[model samples]
Target: MAYTTDFEKLKKQLNFKPDPTRPVSKQASKNTKMLFEYLKSIYGKKHLAGQQYLQSEEVEDLVYYHLTGKLPAVRGYDFMGVSSCKKTDDQVDRAIKWATQCGGIVTMCWHWYAPNDMDDYSKGSSFYYKTTSYDHKTCFDLCKGVTEGTAEYEFIIREIDMVSAELKRMAQLDIPVLWRPLHEANGNWFWWGNHDEQHREAYKKLWYMIFDRMENYHKLTNLIWVWNGQDKCMEVSPDTFDICGDDIYSVKEYDHSSQKQRFEYMTELAHGKMITLSECGYIPDPDEMKKDNAMWLWWLPWWREFVYKREGYKPVFDKDGYTVINKKYMTEDFMKRVMAHPDVIMREDLPWYDKDKHKLPDALSANLERIKSK
Candidate 1:
């Protein structure tokens, strides 16, 4: 996710004089370019966005793009490496809408599913269950997907159905929907996280059930399914996945000689579905791959590099036949691929809630506030 290259580090790594005016394009920038192009090829733009199930009147221009953030790779656009000044969810929506106006998604997350509020309990923990009792909940379904039989999954299922209907209404407005549900289930810690010893089976079952019920009953097919999760589990069930959602956490893990052993095994199993690093935040290492411009690795947040960028940190890319994108410290050069990446988004023409970018308008803010208070 970095944009500016370190001339001094480049000099030390390549053992040459640093470029005085311009940063060296990793010297192997060509490989990075090729990898990105390949990623774009696979992401393939989706223009025929099913149906105008969502609608709104605020859209000045209509564009078709398959929104994938908050998908399997980037978690959500919130990982921009910047702590938000906006605290409330409504404010966040307003900010992301700015990005949407620029032809992108306001990809965000409703994370941390703790029920009991215990020290270690997160969203799935009993703390969360007590919270989403009457509300049409999204995170609740995610928690139910991970920990089966904690409470009434039926209630969560009903809530999902209601939300799906709402989604259908949005689609009617020609608003392309990038609906991600219970993502990163493979990454342990989340209520539905899929560690080997954790709720792996439940995770898969939940997705299958969700998909089956929604598509078969609700007929909610106007969604680009994204399966985003970290494969911390040594044994991953690719069959459990309806789509591909691969994530990377540590570049050092990629640099370690064992990275190849770890990632290569997973890639071979992923079955080559439009895959991406949903939560890229790592800096690529200055290794043979970097020499060739092979940046199929994921990116880290821009601010995470505050101390590490100057520490000779290199990214670790341990997989193959894949492209990794980083957005941290992203500059003009970084925006270049985001240039084409957004091209892969599914374009929707719906106008539902478009005035405020799919969120309730300022006028309705009070109603939502009253609902929350109740």
Candidate 2:
């Protein structure tokens, strides 16, 4: 099947125009540029299907494939391991494997635990404002943190250095990442967000600090910055970010609307940049997205429990005896329909998919046959 041919037809149908701007990183890797172009090409025509895993394992991917006979084109990861000093390398290694062995795109966000305050591995390395003693009321004094020679400054810098080293591994392997740091900052739930006017300015400064250290200082160019502050006040400089996104979790369990209102709001906030549903609970129905013209670049459903249901479903056990649920937030029948939809781009449908290089699970063939049979 010719993926490009279908893409062209969809592009013409949607009147899609490729954006001329390059990635925020002037020295972006070749893979990064290609990924960016691919994203722009599909912007108004189709959306990439994505799924997030809480850890390095492919537990969620297995469950998704079991139901839909498809794997997400984009795989999401988190940097919480670095903060917790646990299995950090495993996460990075798995991301590399997904990109090289599975022909998938990688997007990652940082759930940045407070650098100095939290004891190592406390509360399972929670980054939440309420659970930690990080004191959002006064906030970590980002001004001091950005300044040199201060304890606050050294702490954040140390944490950034640790994460940067891992990113450098991916950069060395030429893997382009959709790197989103300080996500959902519009909500007060995360320590980085919901700051007063004074702290908000400091938050922006913190963003710049990380940007400079990574892009210029560390010279890591494989990153495609995805700013997800989710509020205009927390916005970093336009050039510092390649994409803008928002996290939306619907209150109604089965709501599959295009989320047109939130999409438009993010579009306005994006300032001509590409927009995405960076994180979501329920997968948006692609048909509804087309009907409402809320074409996000991609929609990534959160980890296992968010996508799966615990009741009335037989669970598969991992090698380590961990239970993986099969019943999903969306019914199995609906999930199969969504995966089979022409507008949804799955792993094998990606333009870069090479049969020899990208090995898929053997069961996928039979699974897809079952979908066709039904």
Candidate 3:
């Protein structure tokens, strides 16, 4: 497939100004500030392509690279390993490796299993409310969890301390992380969301508590908070998060239409802050996104079965014991096209790859000026 100049013409047609806002964290590290500025610089003009990895093995990224010959600029990692009691350090290590070696941006989310309530480690870590014996009615009390000198408080604090230690490791190395916790709170799948009004208030308290403890107590300035609560009722305080986003997965396999409606809804919820397609199945077509005026800061497609078709038990082996490379939510051709689009920023296109520099590259600065001039 050949790249086209049509996107260049489209870029000229769309007038997008760079966001001059700094990160929400007042004491954010130099790299964190640079990452936020870079994201703002490309908003509405181009978007960073991303892929989430289930583990540090790089299976998902390898599959994407095999199909597109280009790696995603943003690499998504999960802190579920700590919650699950498996590979606790590997996820953090892999994120650091991506930032240091691969020259890619790092985004992380936590699948926080209920603290002190691992009813069945048999099936591994269960972050879902229904998977465990977590009863929001009796067994769980968000108010008690936030209060000091209580059993509930101890449980949550212990977990947060563990995760904080991991985050501090990155901060020590000057790595900026797009930290997204308590994701999909509006959907109610996770223990943090889909609860009563009191619990909802407690959820916000929990967010604030985490922010206070991490930012003030732990002194972790490398984190750029990305809020993913999809509903207005579940939205965190505007000052608490640096960016807000929504997770949308299309049921239609080849649906490449830009999710402009959700984008606009999130934009309203963002309160002047930048918005993103935090998690997605089918990457919206770049041209469609430009036409709809809903260019997200970035989009991260889920792992394994979402990215590639799996016929057998494992993602690698098919029913006939053959290697599977067929596309699933996105077609192979569309994946190539999305990666090859001029408006999509890949790993090789990132301006802050140089570890020594703390400023925007001249090319990106020039592009920002060009967009502003239009």
Candidate 4:
């Protein structure tokens, strides 16, 4: 059965409603809408927290500590193309299985480089950014070839196939993925960014191409596509994405107004799609987020280093002058208390992914009622 059927059915079971004036009904991908309803069912009652772990060695310890009251509600992984070629899927598979078995949400971000670039010249330069204007036409053309089925199309297909193959494998095990590829396109860091009017069109087209190819050609139904929210581009194609993801790295002074404005613009651009603070420099105080009326579906700090840095946890070097982190965060105890709040949803709080029912556990009914009462 299609995963979307279960997703839609869950929405009905929860009796979810859209913001009447700013309705996002029918605009989100089916899976995205379903997931949004699931989160919305408990919006004020609980918040889903997330974090990224770039390496496998970090996974077990991170997940264990978080579950013991030190982390967020979700686990994140990255597909960094720091090498000349793409990374292997073995690690990806391991992460998915580990997160799924523990009943936590799995989120992925791709730091994919332009296909043509190699790390031949500089000491540490990678394939993703070969030149100053890496986000220029050459990169766009490489992606466009897939749509046109040109010579470069084979390479494009190969890259996408690598991703699709994994999704297809996960589909068999009935794992759902919060897939956020080509993120932060509005910024100029990667090849997909730094676009002019023409580049903007190319970006949109590339997004459409990926969606169509993955959904239609690859037959990937498990993904809930999340589009990055940036003011740079005009609103993306309506059907191209399921959610609008915003990354807040600045706002050191806790700029609630700026945060609110960003959310408001994203909401307008989304036109009924769900909006999430997908990444943050600092975990917005839950109270602050509630006060600003900018409740994100979830937020993930950049893992151990950034999480500690943002919280002002000073790093101590060892005898050899190497930094040693015996304590990941100074606010560890404080964060434990914060996450313990009834308004925060931890991994243990999630329902089982009912294989038989093809949706969430039946307890969701009572859970919804409980949230409503709050």
- Predicted structure with the largest TM-score when compared to the true one: 2
Cα lDDT tens digits for candidate 4, 1-374 = 22111323333432333342221323334554455567657654457867766544342233224325333567677655322354454457655654555566778787764445322222233324333554431232534543454545544555666677776776666666788877887765566664466656666655655666677566675677678847646355545566788988863543323277778878887657677888876566667667877777777767656543223544333343222332433255545655676666766566643334333222233333443575
Which tens-of-lDDT digit does each residue in 153-249 have in candidate 1? 5444544564556545534433333444565565444555654453566665555555545544565533444456545443233332323444445
lDDT of each: 0.35, 0.75, 0.74, 0.57
Q: Stretches of candidate 4 above 4 Å error? A: 1-36, 59-71, 81-84, 117-151, 232-234, 251-258, 308-330, 353-374
**Model 4, 327: alpha-carbon shift in Å?**
9.8
How does model 2 fare in lDDT?
A: 0.75
In candidate 3, residue 210 scores what lDDT? 84
Error of 2 at 43 (Å): 0.7
lDDT tens digits, residues 148-171, model 3?
Answer: 777767767877888999899989
Between candidates 1 and 4, which one is better according to lDDT? Answer: 4
Clashing residue pairs in candidate 4 are 24-272, 49-73, 113-128
